[model samples]
Target: MDRYVRSTRRAGGFTLIEVMVVVVIIGILASIALPAYQDYVRDSKRAEAKAALSLVAQRMERCFTESNTYVGCYGGATVNSDSGNWVVSITESAASYQLEADTSAQHSDGECDPMTLTNTGATSPAACW
Candidate 1:
């Protein structure tokens, strides 16, 4: 009777080594997953910066059409209300314009720090767009 009870109890539970092996496997998987998730988040934020630059470009074009020049457009604004993750700026003259979207203070990083779009519709770091 004593032997039978001990066997039943042991069979019902996992050994320490088995539990530890499972834990180690989970830890290894998490280690691999975490960095990939971070990259995905950073890329999504980059999209926000790109979109902000495009919006600013459209506005500048409108301003040019109305006044035949890009100066004084947007009143020299540096922040775009439409995009929350980027700071937008424009440098322009009667002939051409350059629009830039720099990462906001809180989200700044080297991967996609600043995205640019020009009046000629050229995008820098073209892979980002």
Candidate 2:
């Protein structure tokens, strides 16, 4: 009578199904993270544009207060407001200066809502316009 003992070897590595499952989970997680990261990047860009525009606007406000009406803002600063990519633009109207910003300021397809910030910040950027 020969008695058979179970094989002593244990599973030594991951099975194909286990590997695939892990890969799929990682992919799903990456997919979820990617969009959030993109949105965060876009938000950061918007904030940066706002800060830059605010700086220029304050300068313009000072100039205007001394003279009345916008005296123009940052130019020749190497930051093009009309580039075909991310950009910031401030246009001076007859009574107020408009600070328009977008995540992608170019392509002419992005939402470029003008953030009308008066030069003097009289209303201040934090206030109206």
Candidate 3:
């Protein structure tokens, strides 16, 4: 009877080793998932920046069609990407323009940081565009 009772009590709950093993498995899965999730977020932000850049360029084109110049295309005001992840700065001349999307948040992303677009329909840091 004692043996039966002892066996029943032992089986009623998980052992420390079992709990530890489960914890380790969870940790491993999290370690793998966390970085992948971060990468996805970063990529999405980049895509947003790219789209914002394109939209700004399109707006500039429309302005140029009306005014025949690029100087006042963006209205001489500060611009930020739609998602607020990038700040857009324009370098313009009478006939040409360059748009730069810069942000401290993406500074660590050397390969894609400071994405650029030109009036000639060119994009820099080719891997990012």
Candidate 4:
């Protein structure tokens, strides 16, 4: 009679500890990337505010040149950007004007909540611009 011997061996597969390590690595990467992505989005939205302010300032300048005054320019109304991400308004006089972009309502988390531009083309919160 011939006798057969049985051998015990485990199948190849990922262990729970290995899987957990991979999940932890992914979580760490996500935590690092999420804040960066949010900041990028906020910065891009800020560009919209800056551009809207610039456009309004140009119109105000043209109105001043034509009428010798800033009155009635844009009808003293707040103008919104095409994307509606920013609200732009101007405070003007015969000699000077200040344009502001208010992002509080649309983008409250933005680092530069409110940006300002002057007739002289000066931008505020200097780092943002």
What's the TM-score of every candidate structure?
A: 0.81, 0.61, 0.86, 0.81
Q: Root-mean-square deviation of each candidate, in angstroms?
A: 2.8, 5.5, 2.8, 2.6
lDDT of 1 by residue, 45-64 (tens): 88778777877888888988
User: What lDDT does each candidate get?
Assistant: 0.81, 0.56, 0.84, 0.82
Question: Candidate 4 overall Cα lDDT vs. reference?
Answer: 0.82
Model 4, range 10-126, lDDT digits (tens) per residue? Answer: 789999999999999999999999999988988888788878888898899898899988878876588888987788877877778888888656467455767899888898878
**Model 2, C-alpha of 80: deviation from truth (Å):** 4.9
Error of 3 at 2 (Å): 11
User: Which ten contiguous residues of candidate 1 have the minimum total lDDT?
Assistant: 2-11
6-124: candidate 2 lDDT, tens digit per residue: 77798799999999999999999999999999777655555555666676666777767777766344432324333334455666754676555444433332333433344445332
Q: Estimate the overall C-alpha local distance difference test score of candidate 3.
A: 0.84
lDDT of 1: 0.81
Q: Give the residue spans of candidate 4 off by over 4 A.
A: 1-9, 109-111
Question: Model 1, 123: alpha-carbon shift in Å?
Answer: 1.6
Q: Best by TM-score, which number?
A: 3
Question: lDDT value for candidate 2?
Answer: 0.56
